[model samples]
Each structure stands twice: as C-alpha cells, then as structure tokens.
Target: MARRKIVRSPDLMLLRRALKHLLPGALLLAAAAALPRVPSLWRLVLELLPIYFSLVFVGGFLLAWQFDRSRIALTLLVLALADRALLHGGHNVHDVVALLLPVNLAAFSWLKERGLLTPRGAIKVGALLLQALGVAALARAHSPAAVSWLSHPLVTWPALAAVPLSQPALAAWLIAAGLAVARFVTRPAALESGLLWAGLTTLLALLAGKTEPLLTFYIATAGLILVVSLMETSRSMAFDDELTGLPGRRALNEELLKLGSRYAIAMVDIDHFKLFNDDHGHDVGDQLLRMVGARLLSVGGGGRAFRYGGEEFSVLFDGKTREEATPVLEKFRAELADTPFIVRGKRRPRKKPSLPLPAGSQKKVSVTVSIGVAEPDGSHGTPDRVVKAADAALYRAKRSGRNRLCT
Candidate 1:
C-alpha cells in the first residue's frame, strides 16, 4: 500500500493567506447575488447604476492615491473611461471595449507598478490615450463592420455559441485569468487576488451587456473590491512585521487595550541573538526571526504571539493567570531549545541541506528563549505597566540564567 503524504502547518498557513485576500471581492459578489430582483425597483436600480459606479470609481481613485497603490487607481480610471465610451458610442465602440478591456486590464495588473508621475507612468498614460483614440478611430472608420469582425464566432459548435463573449474577447479573458491565477499562486497579495476576481466581474459585466444594470452592478462591485482590498493591504502592512510575518508592536498595542484584568503577558527573548546576527549576517538573522515567529504562532496555552520588535516576542494569554501561564511558557522555551535550526550559508546546497556540513557551509544549531510571565496586579494597574512588569521579570530571567522562564 502506498502511504499518504500529510499536509503540514505551513501549507495550511499558505492556503489561509491566499484565501484571506479573496474575502473582500467574494463578499461583494455574494451581496450582488442576493440583491432583490423586484421589477419596479430594477429600473430604478438601472438608472442609478451609472451614478453608483461614478461614486465608487471616483472614491476608489482617491483611496488608491491615499494608499499609494497606483495600479488600482489606474485600473479604476481605465474602467471609468471604458464605461463612458460604451455610454456615448455605438455598437462598434462596445465591440472595441469588449475586445480591448481584458487585454488592457491584463497589461495594467501584470506590469510592475511604476508610480503615476514618472517616466514609465507617462508610457502607461500614452497607452491609455492610444486605446481611447483607437476606439474612436475604429468606430468612425469602420461603422457597423467593426462589430461583425470583432464579434465573429471562431467556432460553429452549439456549445461555443452559448458562451456570452466573442472569440477574441474570450481568448483574452482566458489568458488574463491564467496570468492572474499564476500571479496569485506565486505571491498571494491583495493586488494579485483583486486582479483575479475583478477580471471575472468585468467579464460578467460584458456578458450582461455594457449598458445593462447588471454591468453597473458587477463593475461597481469590482471597483469596491479594488478599493477595499487596497485598504486591507494597507492595514496589513501597518500592523504586520514584513520580515517575520508576525503581528508587530502596533498590533500588540491594540490587542493589549482589549484585554481583561486576569490576562497574562509573557515576554520572550532569544538568547545571544545579536551575537548570532553579528556572527552570521542580517539576512540570516531575518531567516531566524521568521522561523522563530512561526514557532511562536504555535505556542500553547491559548496564547497569541506578537513580534515585539528585534529579537524579542510577546505572548498574550487572555484570562490566564501568571502561575498558570508560566508552565506553558516553560514548555515552549524547552521545545524551542530542542528544535535544531539549520543555518544556511552562502555555499549551502541548492536542495535541503542535511547533517555534517561541507566545509562549514551549513550547520544545525539549537536556539533557546528566555520567557517572563506577568499578571495584572495593583502594582501594575494599566496594560503598559503590566508589560513593563513582564519586561522586568524578563530581565530577571536573563540575569538568573539564559534560556529559562521567570515569574
């Protein structure tokens, strides 16, 4: 019998990260599905669609500017322009937008974010101008002929006819979707995932007819997702440590505010971390911090970990006493001491390097932590004071002996 390979914690963590970025768009899409389908209100909603989209796009542009996510701002600008073109121009322009949008969106999203006021940004601006000019030129030059040529079905099969898009448009959507998926898989971020779902919503809008209320609904949803995800990304960047992927000091500060009277705070510090950093390098030190943060995430006793800056970390145990949390912190300290951390050097092998280093290129070493647990007391009335008390205990722990827990 063949053995089944088990999925580990890191894989699950990666999956969670990918899915989290999809939440904003997915929620809006769900809301769109649940909208009331009343006949009387439907026309009103249709009339309001353009107005609604105008607000969403304009507001989204301002937010993108605030967050400095230029890609989202530009995408919204282009989408707004397309909406305007479809409203003013005829069938040829519709065909022009249907064919051009997916391709342009793919280009805008996949291209590196060059800031809007720069040389590269000028090129992007030029591209936008060219797209608009092409639509106008084509509409005036070809009249109704452009629609027939652009909408010509590539396949005569009955199944293919049921698809709501023209051949070139469908092909472009498919390629754009593939790129979005690939980008999301490689680096799970708001931009990549937003591009993936926003592209789908745009395609759905095209399927429903550009001037239809459904178009407004999907396009508005797309704009909202782009804006909201950029906000989410901005929040994540603020509260998360870039190197460790752990909650930073600001997050810890907010969390501390929400704690009750009986909570325990444990300050954890890696022993001789500076010596390690100096001996190895900052890059290696970063790797160590990430590894340590990962381990801290799995600490026991209902504790939530935060990267409390540098080589220090903090674990907040809501509603737990100091005595109760001490043993848990001790166990964590001992377990971390036992786990061997492999330090990969410049000459380390491309594959996973195993025991017995080849001329000191790689080596396995045990890392340990000193922990101090504190509970709220009359002496430490406030959260900040409690943290200071915990730090004092941590200093005591370090003084007594390294790699041990203190009360």
Candidate 2:
C-alpha cells in the first residue's frame, strides 16, 4: 500500500514554525482563562506580574542584544518601563499611555539599529528615559489642569468618546496607526508587523478598563508578542536567504530531516554565473539570482525550492522519482532559457528610466540553468548522501553540457 505523502512547502513550513513559537503564549493566555477569575487569583497574578515582567524583559533584552536587534531591544525597554508606569493604572496612566504608546511605537519601530553600547544608543536610551520621567512627573503633579489636559476631547463622535481612551488619545492612536500602516506598506518587515499587532493587543487591554484577570492577561500577551517577535526575527535571519528571499541551507537541511521515502532532490546551478559577476558586477549577478528565485517559487510538480548556496538552488519533489521530476525541471529550464534578461546601465533608475539608454549599452543576456535530480537508494541511505548523488549528477550535466539536466 502507498503511504500518504507529506507535502512540504516554504509557506507551510513557515506557518508551522510560526505556530510552534506562538503556542506557548496562546496556552498561557488560555490557562489564565481556564482558571477561576476571582479576587484571590487576581491578587496572586497582580503580585506576580512584576516578577513575570522582570524575568521576561531581562531575558528578552539580553537575547535581543545578543542578536544585535537594537530596534527590538529598545522596544523591549520602552514597553517594560511603560508597564511599570501604567500597569497599575491610576492618575490617568491609561490616558497617558494611550496618547504616548502610538508615538513611541512609530518612533522606535523605524529607528535603524545602533549598537547598544554606542553614543547614539545612549542618546536613544536617554530620550526614552526623558519620556518615562515626563510620564512620572505628570502622574505626580495630578492637578485639575493636568487631568483636563490629558483627557480633553479631540473627537466628539459618540461611539469614540465612550471608549476608555480619551478623544485626544484616540486621535493620536489613529495617526500612529496610519503611520505604522504606511511604513509597513512601503517597507514591510518583521518588527513593523509585530509592533502593529502589539499595539492592537495593548489597545484590547486598554478597552477592558481596569477589569480583573483579563486586563493583566492581555498586557502579558502583548509583552509576549514583542518577545516572541524578536525570536521570529532572529529565526528569519538564520533560516532565510536575505538576498533571494528563499529558504536558506539551514531550512533545506531542516526539511530534509522530515522527508519520506519517495522523494527526488534536484540541485540546480546557473550556467556561467561567475562570468556574469566578473563581466558586469555583483549587482547584476544579484539580479539574475533574484529572477531565478522568483521563477522557482512557481515551479511545477509540487516542487519546493531553496537557495542552497551561492548561485545554486535546490528543489524537492515529494512523492516522485527522477523520471517524474524531469518534466517539471525541463519546463522550468526551457522557460528560463527563453526569457530575455536585461542588463541596464548604471545610471538607470529602478522605476521608469529617466534618461534614454545608449545603443547596445543595455542588452539582453542569455541565461541557462543546469540541473541534476536523484532519489534515495539503499546505498545512499541518508538525505545527505542522496544530495551528494544529486551533486555528482549535476557535475556530470555541467561537464557534458552547460544547459541541461541529468539524473
């Protein structure tokens, strides 16, 4: 009987990875809800909140620093201080945080990474310290003028006015949210997405408005999002190729560990890639890799692609032999070979070309790929051995001819 084949896709692989990282936080929130929400439990959670926040921040900050994620490290520092200032929520703590959180998120989210021990890092830290002190000073000088200033209505709409956040705070949140969305749309990344979600999570906590159990739980969940985001960011750094945006060698190895018996591995190399780099430049070489990687994403026969290393890529066809995978590779190679790759002049704009090109300056470069496919054998018992066999086949293909596939 044929066993059920487990398909592996970069998308599904990433989804599984994300779920793995998020499960603990979800379970923690669920467990909090599963237990009684009475006064006794509230007291215990509230008392322990300080300890929990301390450990998470200290540990998360160290990890972020070690990973050299200055953005994440600064964000952690800001949120922890905010929690200390506003977690208890008296004397307009909610109002202040609502007004300030969005601005802080936008500001810190976009700041480029400066090392923690550097002068710029000290300035950034000082700026945050000043903000925290300002919040503390406002909290202490809780007179009528200060209270009204913090709670003044910026939006007069009935629905918005009724929410826990003051009209002014709501307005600020809206502006900050817009900025966050714009920044993300223009330059999407892990931290921007994380901060956007974390802002929404914090807003959820703010909506509960001093409600026992739920408020603290949501706050903790928000913190967890920030912490886990750093881990995810680090994970991407390791597992994904930064240039081509394909799964890196590490991800390929991880996938190989989960393979079934009937699977074919195809090792592909761009023909004369180094010639392109040497004649043109590394930039042109980069463009070729990107074009190839983009095409590989839509490969046929249910093959998943990886940026194996350098100008080489690997594709895995689950539940297939070399014969079955050949047609797919043939199609891909034919398409790539037929496509005209343009080498633009140095001054050419990335968008519409501002100036006309000189004749023969920008010309089409012929591109081709050599591929080798292999399946596991009794002698080649392991995934690594199968890959080596595939590599040997690839070398044979290259030797015989530069633009062909072998099995």
Candidate 3:
C-alpha cells in the first residue's frame, strides 16, 4: 500500500498576507475601471499619475516608511492598468471593489500580528485609496450621465462612502454596506456572508443588463478570496505541530526572524525521556509528553510555545530581556514538577480532570522535565545558532542531574 503523504496547510495569518497583496490590486483595478463615468476621474488619474510616480520614487526614502514589499506594490500598479483594460468607463464595479478595503483591513487586524494598516500597511492602503478616489472623481467629471457613486468622495471612498445619489447605485451601495457591517460584527464566520452578498449583487447586476464590469469585478473578488483561503490552509499546517498542539519548528524559525529586539528563547526537555519510553512502553511515554506539553503551554503566557520534536519543546519571550523571562521559566519548572501522567489502562470515563472518573479507580503515572535558557541576539547570524545554544545548555542540565534548569 502507498503511504499517506502529509498535506500542509497555510494558517489564517498567511492567507491574510496573500490577500493583502491580492485585495489592493483587485480593489484598485475595480476603482480604475469605474472611472470615466465622472469626467474629473480622468484628470485626476493624469494629475495623480505624477504623485503616484513620486510615491514610487520616495516609497523607499525612509527605511521605516517602506513596506519592503516592492513586488506586491508593483503588482498593484499593474492591476491599475488591467482595470482600465477590462472594465473602464462608467461601470458598476465600484460596489464590489469598495468592499475590499474593509475586508483587507479587518482581516489584517484580526488574523495577523502584522497588518496592512501597520505603518507599511498604511502606505499600501494610502496608495490604493488615492487611486480609487482619483478614479471616482475622474468618472464623475467626465460623464454627464454618470452616477454619484462614480463621483462624490462620500460615495466613492473605498472604506465607506457618503451614500450615492442614483437609486440603483444607492441600493447596491447600501446592500454592500450592510453586509460589510455584519461581517465586521462577527468576523471569520461572518466573512463568508459578506462575500456571498457581493457575489449575489454581481449576479443581480448581470441580470439587469450591462453587466460586463460587474461580472469582471465579481469574478476577481471570488478569485482573490479563493487564493487567500488556499494559502491560509497551507500556512496553518506548516507552522503548527499536530501532536503537541504547539508551534512546529518551522514556525519558531519564522517567529524568530520577525523578532524586534531583546527576547528570550528557552529549550525544554522531558527528564530521562528515553528511559520512560523504554520502561513504561511508548503509550505511557506519549502521555507524559502530553502532560509536559500542557504545563509548558500553561506557563507560556503570551509567548509562543513550540514543539521542537520528540521530548523537546521551546518557548519565546517577546519584548523582554533574559532577566524578565527567568521568573516565568522558574514558575513553569515548579508547576510541571507537580504534573502527573496516567499510565495505560488506568483511565476513568474521560481522560482529563473535568470529566468524572470511574468511582474507586484513581491511579496515575508521571514524569518531569529540564530546561535551558538563552537570550536572542539580533546580530547573531541566524535563529538556528541561537536554538542550538539553548539545546546544548539543555544537555548540560540533563547531565548535571535531570529536572533542573541551566542557562
């Protein structure tokens, strides 16, 4: 029989990052296509072209000002062109495209530690916003029969417009707005509803006639959502440990790379771990590992706890110097020393404490762990070296005598 291959999935955070790139482009493209309905939109695009050029020029002027994501930034620029090519001139693409702003910002804020609204995030947001606003102005000034949705800032702002004058436009805008509100009230779960609303609106526009631009916008929105979902699923599987419910080694490396300054990295190992497995058999050994894993998680606080593989784990303390994490580490050591492991064949109805155990049957087994501590040095070549240092220290602790900590 062929062995089953493990499938890795992206976490919600990665999906959100990918969407960060896709949404801006898609939104700006929609806005660009919506232009031409307002005469001023053309003039603004022309006038603002120079400004956008300047932004591109000065985008890297200050290290702090830069998003450092040049590839995605350039992609947004290209998307501008695509919008004009596919859906230009007084179209009904605004409603769908406008939805991207809230979706993008909200997802970034909630799912990822980093967001599009972050300093770098704001730059992309500003760029895309400027483009959308410029288009709305151009479309209104250019076309006499053009609708208010294509003109007024209140109506055209990607975040939330003032409300359009045209009944159809106003109706569409209102519907989109309502869905957006609902999504915000309950994110993740409600996010799908907002997407559905956008999709349904596009369908309505198609049935009403002159649906080319609307259809294009709808297809693109759906595509962006799909891309983000796919990436998110992949990110999760890559970063999280399946067995211990902690971060996997790959995720630890990624987290360390993003570390700002002054942090602690600690290595934890079950004391005499191999002996437990040999004497009690693999099943009991697994139970002890899980118990230790739970204790580590309890003491991890806000820091990330990761499984570094069999019988080994790690924790990262952010924004704190080594001294700051010492108390926490000591606390964890003390708490874990008291944890117990249930031997095979000694369980009640439920495995853990909350569930009632069978009356009169209360016997459990247990084990302990040793730890090694290290402070991260940004100047150091890589996270691996730092982790190795902690690992070495961990071995020293075990040699000195199991169930003790070393730095």
Candidate 4:
C-alpha cells in the first residue's frame, strides 16, 4: 500500500501541474482571436506579432519552468515593445524610453525573487517613476511648440494630458494601453512596455502627421492608468493568504463583515500546539503549521483556507451546510492524526546544529488538529458571532479529545 501510494503521488502532482498551463493557454488563445476587429487593430497586431511570438515562447518557457505566468507574460510584452522600438530605428527620446520601461519592470521581479524588495518596494517604485518621467520628457521634446515651455506646468499640462492620445498620439497610446493590459493580466512587464509603446507610438504618429491628436492622447493615457491600477489591486489581492495576509486585524474584520449565504465556517486548531512547539522546536512548529494549512486546503477545496492567526485556521465552504461539511472535515482531522510528521529534512540546519538525533527518528514528535464547525445561524447574528460560536465548539472538541471535530 505504501509503495502504491508513493508511486501514485508523482502522477497526481503531474496532473495537477498540467492543468495550470493548459487552462491559461486556452484562455489567452481565445482572447487573442477575439480582440482584433478594425484595420488599425490589424495594423497594431501586425506590428506586435513577431515580438509577441518571441515573447510568448520565451516568456512562457521561462515562466513554466521557474516563475509565475502573469509576470513572464507581462515582461515579454515589455520586451516586445522594446524590440519594436529598436526595429523602427528610434534614436529620439521616445525611442530611448521605449527601450527602458520593460527592463525596469523586469528588474522588480529580480529584486523580489532575491527577497530584496521587502520593507517597502522603494527601489522598484523609483525605477517606475524614472521610466514615466523619461517617457514624459521624450514626448515633450518632440513638440517644438511645447519644448521651450515644457517645464511650465500650465503650458505642458494640456499636451501631457493629450500626447499619447491625440491623432498625433493615438499610436503610442494604443501600444501603451495594450502593454498596460498585458502587464496587469500577466505581471509587471506590461508596465514598461506599455509606457514605451505609448510614448513611441505618440511620437511616430505626430511625425507622420496624424490629425485629432488631443482626443486620442487623453483617452489612451487615462485608460492605461485606470486599467493598470485596477489590475495591480487585483493582483495583490489574489496572491494573498486572504486571512493573515492583510496587516494588523483589519483583514479579519473586513472578511467578517462580508459574510453571506448558507456557508459552513470551520475553525481548526492545532492539537497541543504549544507543547509540540516546545518539544520539537519552533522550526518544526512552523512546518507543522504549513502542513496543516496545506491539508486543510486540499480537503476543503481550493478557495477557502485562511490562516486565522497562530495554529488556528478558518475555512468557509460554499454550497454546503454545516452538517454536510462535518464528515469531510472529520476525515481530514483523522488524516492529520494518522500521519507522522518526521522533522528531519524539513528542519533548518542552523536551528539545531550538533544535536545528534537519529537521522530518521520518528520519536521526537507528532501533531494533530481539532476543528469546530459552524453553520450560519441567520437569527443568531453577525459573522463575528458565528466565528465565536465555532471557536467555542473548537474548545469543546479540544477538551473532549485533542484530535477530533465538534459541531
């Protein structure tokens, strides 16, 4: 049975991994096929194609292997814009900017991967600002009527407002907007590429004698800002653990306020966690926490695991009453008790050096969890009260027996 289980594990992992790639590719292909309509869109698509192909392949490959898809896709778009600018023989300020934006955005990921961007992503913000400023300057330099007075806020505001959007600005704005959408849809790369595309397109359109530059520039710039801002907000929310991800206690309060529907809220607590942490070490305790979270997520479906501080987790199940969720929760609780958490490879070397325990010792510790289940009591009150009731039930389970569930 153990051999069969070990053999089956890799196959399960492989199947789960494949779905992530297949689903996104199918969605992107559908979107790409449906988005183009006008002659100008065709022209834009044509200009973007080579770079797009190179980006999709190279970016997809790198992302599939190492990084997240959204970031890679966004980066690829930015690189594509740079390649487009270089191909068009742009040496002017707009051309230089077209080259720099994507690179800067890509740099954010590099810094982040190294764990260097924490405590505030100040460097990353600075880089983005620099790119924005460069694009603004380049756009200003191209217009002779505005060059002398570019520094004058009153004089430049109108042009700055319209450059990427006017008939003279339309091309750049389109590119910028496309890049912005890509960045938000995918990751950070879109940001730089979008700005460059917008800046360069605007300059090219102006030089080529486009009519109605003002309306074109305003709409494009404003639209990109709005889209990118929304995407950034969404991206932040999606990656969060949802329960403990927000700072302070505000996140929990916010979630409690939003509860609705006939949902089952499960409050799970690690059985004897304080003693377990003391007996093994905090390192093992941390691993136990993560393992418990993973188990809860696996059994409770993909979308509902929440770290409700310390060794406690709160899971809200949609489409199930409290009674229906009980058996499923109990089964998972039993699984946790049955599994032996051997802390060998999972421990940090520096945390317990030279303390010679058997390399494969299973005697050090074991962990289990207790869960309190609650259903929405419509007449009982708010979500907070519901949670408190569940907590009371969880305490009851812990008192009755450490590794069990109570409703």
Top-TM-score structure, candidate number: 1
Q: Give the per-residue lDDT of model 2 (tens digit) for 139-208.
A: 7777547667877666567787668878777777788778866765554556666666666666666677
* Local error of candidate 2 at residue 48 (angstroms): 8.4
Q: How many clashes does the backbone of model 2 have?
A: 0
Model 4 C-alpha lDDT per residue in residues 1-407, reported as the tens digit of each score: 45211100122322332343234323433343344445676577567655545544454435423433333343434444434333333235433543354344434333333212343434544545565565556555665444333223333345556443223223334444555445434432333333333333333433322222222332233223223433433443554443223222345556666767666778888888888889778866776665666566567542266777888888777667788888888888776676666564443453345775655553434567889988777654567777788899899998997788888
Candidate 1: pairs in clash: none
Better of 1 and 2 by TM-score: 1
Instruction: State the lDDT of candidate 3 residue by residue for 351-381, as single tens digits.
Output: 2467656755644544667888777665443
TM-score of 3: 0.44
Whichever of 3 and 4 has more lDDT, that candidate is: 3
Cα error, residue 118 of model 1, in Å, equals: 0.9
**Candidate 4: misplaced stretches above 4 Å?**
1-34, 37-108, 112-239, 242-261, 301-303, 344-364, 378-381
Which pairs of residues have clashing backbones in candidate 2?
none
Better of 1 and 4 by lDDT: 1
Q: What's the distance in Å from true for residue 123, model 2?
A: 1.3
Off by over 4 Å in 3: 1-227, 344-355, 358-360, 376-383
Better of 2 and 3 by lDDT: 2
- How well is each residue in 69-114 modelled by candidate 1, as lDDT tens digits? 7789888988877767766677778777888888877886778887
